[model samples]
Target: MEEKKLNELTNEELLVLKKKSKSTKVINASIIGFCVGIAGYSLFVAGITWPTIFPLLLAVIAYKYLGKNEKAVDAELKSRNLS
Candidate 1:
C-alpha cells in the first residue's frame, strides 16, 4: 500500500507509524547484516568479484529504501513533539 505523506497522516496514524517503524528498523537491519555477511563471505572465498560487490551494493540500496519511510515518520513525530 502507498503511504500518505507523514504530514498528511493523523496523530493516531502517526503513532501507529512510529510503532511500525521500530519493528521495520529491526527487520531492515537484519537484512542489511545478512547482505553484508554474504558479501564478506564471497570476498573471502572468491575475492573482488561481482558476487562480492553485488551484495554490498544491495545492502546499501536496501538500507536506503527500507529506512526511508521510517526516517520520514521519525522526523514528522519529532516535529510534532510526539517522539
Candidate 2:
C-alpha cells in the first residue's frame, strides 16, 4: 500500500502515528532488555554456547532495527513540525 505523504496527513493522523511510534519504541526496548538478560544468564551459567550467542545476536539486531525505525519516525515528525 502507498503510504500517505507527511504533508497529506491530517493533524490527528500525525498524532496517532506519533503515539504508535512511542508504543513501538517501548516494545522494542523491552525485547532488547529481555534478550540481554537471557544472554547474560546463559553466559554465566552455561559458559560460551549457542543460547548465549543467539540472544546476544537477537539483541543487537533489535537494537539496530529500533534505531533505524526511530530515525524514520523522528524525521517524519520533525518534517511535520510536531514533537
Give the whole-model CA lDDT for all candidates, comma-separated.
0.86, 0.80
- Best lDDT goes to which candidate? 1
Candidate 1, position 25, lDDT: 83
lDDT by residue (1-83, candidate 1, tens digit) is 23456678889999997787778888999999999999999999999999999999999999888887877787888888998
Which regions of candidate 2 fall more than 4 Å away from where they truly are? 1-8
RMSD (Cα, Å) for all candidates, in order, is 1.9, 2.5
lDDT for each residue of candidate 2 in 1-83, tens digit (9 for 90 to 100): 12446557677877787777778888999999999999999999999999999999999999987767457656777876787
Error of 1 at 69 (Å): 0.4
Candidate 1 — what's its lDDT?
A: 0.86
